[model samples]
Target chain A: MVSDLSVLLTDRQGQPYSLTSERIKHLEYLCESTRRDIVDTLYKIGRGHAGPSLSMVELLISLYFEELRFDPSDPKWPDRDRFILSKGHGSLGYYAVLAQRGLIEKRELDTFESLGSRLQGHVDSNWLPWVELTTGSLGQGLSYAVGVAIAAKRQAKDLRAYCLLGDGECQEGNVWEAAMSAAKYRLDNLLAIVDWNNLQGGVTLEVMPSLEPFALKWQAFGWHTIEINGHDLQAVLQAYHQARQTKEKPTVIIARNIKGKGVSYMENKVEWHGGTVTKELHQIALEEINARLSELSQYADEKYGRNHG
Target chain B: MANWKKAPIREALGKTLVELGDRYPQVLVVNADLRNSVKSIYFMEKYPDRTIEVGIAEQNMIGVAAGLASLGFIPFAVTFARFASKRAADQISMSVDYCRNNVKIIGAYAGIFTGAQGVSQQMIDDTAAMRAMPNMTVIDTADVHEVRSALLFAAEFSGPVYIRIGRDEWPVVFDETYTFELGKGRWLREGSDVVLLNSGILLPYAVEAAELLESEGISAGVVNMPSIKPIDAALINDISRNVGAIVTLEAHNVQGGFGSAVAEVTAANYPVPIEMIGLRNEYSESAPNDALLEKHHLNPPWIAAAAKRALDRKNRLRC
Candidate 1:
């Protein structure tokens, strides 16, 4: 079933852009493999961060594979684009992407949360590559991203910064501060994506809802707004393509997602937000994820030919 | 050996920043609607492109400063001490200090010396809070000379720095030729009977206390320990050895300001008979500037009296 998943995509010209789709499929595979890697590592060490990782799988794939201009080989490449995981709890997605991209050794993924692993429960730039800022406290990453964006603009550098925020985390006052500043400066080179997975820890996003016409808020704040289905790889790629044409205002891709999209029992369940994967539950999750992988691969084959062909 | 003259440190800081702006284009200043109050008006006027006025938003101002710092720019974030310390503390902790950003925080109207504005506006504990943070350089310039030197030093130094400047007209204590070194204490009036350790605007009162002690035949040594975080422990140890007892003075809360730092060091390393002369845990209710200092027992006479009391206590304990 895992073997059936294929990578395929389309470009801006509306032509059959197979490389984009293929890379995205690889990204999703990276997410699944790394998801298991993170869960197993977390289980061995402790518990607290799987649901957030699961929700941001497709979003991370689209950014890493389609949008960002980063060299995994040279993480500190000066001219390289910056990516900030504002919702740091979803760092497992980032770690998996980094590992698959060859930024870090695949073996290093197993050591996550160990006595001295660089893969902390939260993202720390001190340990990882391409992580622009060390974020865990929430609401501060957007501000940091704004700073990086402003610097890039002031220097007239071609480099851009992309920051990913969790919908639950956007309620922080500092996020608005950053949003206001990003618009005021006309930071077109900056892009902010919200992982609008409708669940927070131990409660639904509806309970503590920051969801009244959310995309309009960014539009009102002078940002180029783009809302899409987060789980749809094609939609995610399309949003990124459109954001590039944005001239004066910063772009916000508010990707609506589920807490646990693929796994059956975990879907939209707040309990999965930060829970440990028990061996029994882990097996069930693997089976469910395997089924989804096959479904994705079938969709890819119907849309585009096989990778070799 | 040190220059002892009258220069307001706040003015020197402004001058030094203006010069720095000329030298480095990346030197940016973000004012929290306190451009004139903190004397950053010069930087704003001189380099309009580099200066940002965040309009009374201390939290956003600090957040912006931290962001700018992360992007390899030297951002001097300025605001009145009260707002910078009390209001924008979270941003300081998360964005600037925790992230180890090269951001400098210039605090004006620090302490009760903000004249008749009362305790509501006057920040007396900004230095102490800044000092408590990791990798933070907390400085209180003695005079205009030291302020100039401190600005240059902060520019060269990496990581976070907090400079507390007085709002009222403060008498210049350091001379034009005075040298300011990072983490080093300056010994002004050296004596053996008692040691008066102080920093910021209170250093002037400490000098006056030394003169009064001399008139009474009490050899009081006055040390200007401005950099509060990486405290002058060597000087503290030397004072404990040379002077019989020690008296710490500052126009701040006795609870955690300069005096509290000195007490913590001296008590742990060498238990000396120490007297702390500062505000008596009471908020100011808009009194005349000088009257408030006298009322809080932070004036020269009060400091001198405290020194003598400490000396007597040391002698009594020795007996």
Candidate 2:
């Protein structure tokens, strides 16, 4: 129960680089299943975010399954690492991770976007305080994370704050304001991840006022930047590790990913940011994700044993 | 007129914070680098670790406050009224109000008394803007003592609260015994002809106007309204029905501020003749506080004059 982040990260539960082949396979399985779950859930709901939700599946899976500390039994665990989805529009992905980790009841997933549902379209903190901050508007969650990190540091608490923002959200001036504060305070326990799919509102960021030299932007703001392929589980885990090792400054991981990573027709499609998933499109998506799942299943059987989840 | 006590309302916050930090360690102040002007430096001097100065970034200051609030800390996000209500309005609206976070938004230099920082700095619409927000408890305490009382009350309040304080020292209306509560108005005077509905630093002006009206044979009552959002609708309805006429005063725009709030309540519950004395629908120029007050017609003379007008309307309507 010591309030030390180094102790939190390097504990016997498992360190960053210690990812075994079986653990990687398990994470991959979680990723495919999460994608299938998102597509299934969005299909039933008939209209929910698909593109932005589809892009960051691995990014969220690694953090919940392999990174970040928390007890699902106690959402208010004082020592738990905090997570905020700054790109709250892409909430289906975050919800999948929460369900996969058993942080939320799996049956509750179907009630998303329904009247009085706990799982709001954009993340809500009302019923689920573990969500930390209710953020549908972009560019606000980073500053909130900065506040949480400052509070944790001030109290010498081991709780680390993590905020995931969209690449488009970086255009907001509020993000940089928070960045300056985090750097000025040299908050090493704070980590900001930009899901750098370079696509927002159905247009490539290059077409819009682009985020060219994005990593250098964080560096100029005095952050330790880690650029990586977001879908790669090992890279995502290592990025989390590198962020932990950096001292005297905050870290930003520019996770390069596709707008729609798993689905064929939806892959990199600009319209899919919140594009509706039709019955035909849903079937294709599940088929594609299941194909990946079966391959990971065979590998798990070879390395370890038959897996149930 | 005997010279009344005058003290800076802005000083009470910092002084109280110093003590508040000692008592409630979870209480923190998020600053936008106007610590000296807003007198938050007093708290910083005592508890440096408790102050999170965001250095001139209002949006980040609010967002940081929301974050701290999410972590169950009482964060008073302090900045100029323009920055708190206008510049970062969305941040406050979405992050603080919509999220219903337990954060105190402190808008300093809230009126024409911005020490000649002028047009850009003088924020007259803060009361209007903040009061328009849902789930936000808007309070503009009248004096230094009431400001301290409100701050102490805010520590106990759970939802988002917007507290507006003027910059320079002005006339103090209430004594140290005046306690603050949400959605309540205290009657400063009781008159049958007309009522002066006032909020914020203009309380003394309304009081003075009531006294002046008494000198003239016009019986003008004064009611100090510290809470604006959960406004004193019951008191306002009582005045409108029984007192017959109302003259509303604030150091803000007359459109959607304290005056309009009264008008809205009376229009629905008990309709009456309401005269508003504050900034007309226009921007104010940079000038000395007194000059700005004089130019905006928010001084005691203008308030007394407005009350007379309301009395005239009341008598005419009766006939």
Candidate 3:
């Protein structure tokens, strides 16, 4: 159930664009559609990371549709802004966003995790040109992002590098090593967003109770830290804008997210972190997403006229 | 013998990196707090802007190097072989090798070269670990000239490469006129009875062993196999068929080092009796370089004895 609703498009030059209430509704609708796609894709594969992928839908939609600057037709453009999915197990959401952006054929989404499919179980750049780096094992993405940002600084390019990490992935020592180096290089061109879903593999807090002081740890690493409700479209958008304004240091936005935002049964459930989605569960999840999509469309039509729909 | 000048591979690496800095404008050197020890300091001195010092963090250094490579910058990530191959192996596998990033991993103090630092710092199994990774090109520098050439080659080559270098001084195996090529072994001395195949800092010892064998009427051949992966299979096949026996020496463990690489090639192509001379599936203690080499039976006399043993095995099979 794709919608023909058009939102304001930002220019390739990364010029400022106004986000109206109608556009926010459209973004939310898009996020809902992405959730449906994630469920359907995982249900077909019979095995995929459901919780992490579902939680990352809004963040991915915001970046691809609203924040990132690039021509979908030419994904390998040198001057294009880069996005690295550090928590690559959430690639179902990433693939859905890529399909929605028209970067990949929408039909190809069905081939995900299948033999020889470009959309591998984990993110692999070799299989897909849109992916900047191959990542599956956690905590390495920030370092790669730092290198890209350093390159942007050296070449005096105005491009910025963004990485989306998971809260659980932060337990990796390499993430901090990357954080220290990102600050040491004064990588103002770099921005990172951590999906603080609070549940990692098996209840993260139970596994490592010490992860509580997460935001302070990033601040101590010399990053410009911002905390926000990740699902709130407006707050997530504002965090992106604020990060761009920050200078002479890297910025990290700790987006407080639910493990599974939209679906009822999967929310905050670690078992859904990685599992095979059955047909009944898939239908239920799709119905939940579809219901939200319809509500968003009705709100957009009533508030901003039928043309907005 | 007295006139032959010895140069530390680390110094040669630094000098070659500076030369590479001049040649490839996009070349970036990444260090994991071992700049001076790994010889990355030379590149840091010349191209300060191009050098990234990630203090004592090999995992992050490799990830950052992979990131730089993704952006079309050729990054040479330098650290001790022990740390780079062991501590940061997963990062190297995922970030550099799997991604096929053009990151040159210069693993300094490879094998038993970290003498005073003891077995913990020694990387006897790094060759095995690095070679095991798909899309990883493993190179062990034989001498000062080879280390220079290996750096130059790795700088120009576009892929993930692990260049292993020793910490202490080594006798020059190749002169200025010698040219280096990837995956091609060089023949130092040719004989028909037995072939002395070696790599890394042990190449000179192999040559000395060959000389000792010659005096003992053993007519041994010496070949230096620098490229562990994409190894000189043709030379190995030729030696296996014609020479009939082989003795492989390295300043590494025999399990997954140069010897195992040579044995794999010979076992698959031409089955020949082979004797491996190196650390025998065990760790070394803190000692001087000479004592460590002697203890591990990686010295010339021991290597010569191993060659004689292989020759005897070949003769027995013939009988």
- State which candidate has the highest DockQ: 3
Query: By the DockQ metric, which is better: model 2 or model 3?
Result: 3
Each prediction's RMSD to truth: 3.9, 4.0, 3.3
Q: Report backbone clashes per prediction.
A: 13, 0, 0
Q: Candidate 2: which docking quality band?
A: medium
Q: Model 2: runs farther than 4 Å from truth?
A: A1-17, A299-309
TM-score of each predicted structure versus truth: 0.92, 0.94, 0.95
lDDT of each residue in A1-309, candidate 1, tens digit only: 233233344432234544454545655665565555655555665565777887888788667655677666688788788888989888776787777556787677777766778887788876666677778788888877777888788888888878999998888877887888888889888899999988888698778855668988888889999999898876787787777778899999998888876777878888888767778887887777676566565443422322321
Poorly placed runs, candidate 1 (over 4 Å):
A1-27, A209-211, A294-309, B1-9
Top-TM-score candidate index: 3
lDDT of 3 at B275: 96
TM-score of chain A of each: 0.86, 0.91, 0.91
Single out the weakest 10-residue window by summed lDDT for candidate 2 chain A.
A1-10
Question: Best candidate, lDDT-wise?
Answer: 3
True contacts kept of each: 0.48, 0.80, 0.87
| Candidate 3 docking quality: incorrect, acceptable, medium or high | high
Q: Tens digit of lDDT per residue, candidate 2, span A1-309?
A: 112222223421333334455666777887888888888888888767888888899889878766678876798887889998999988787888788877877678899888998888889887566687888788899999999899888778887899999999999989999999999989999999999887889787878776788888899999999999999877887788778888999999999999888888888888888857778877888889888999887543323311223
Candidate 1 interface RMSD to the true structure? 1.9
Candidate 3 lDDT by residue in tens digits, A1-309: 334333333333546555567667877877887788888888887888889988888888888876787776798999899999999998888999888766888789889988999999999988999999888899999999998999888888889999999988988999999999999999988999999998888665567757768889989999999999999987888888888878889999999999988999999997888887778888899889888888886543333321211
Candidates 1 and 3 compared by lDDT, better number: 3
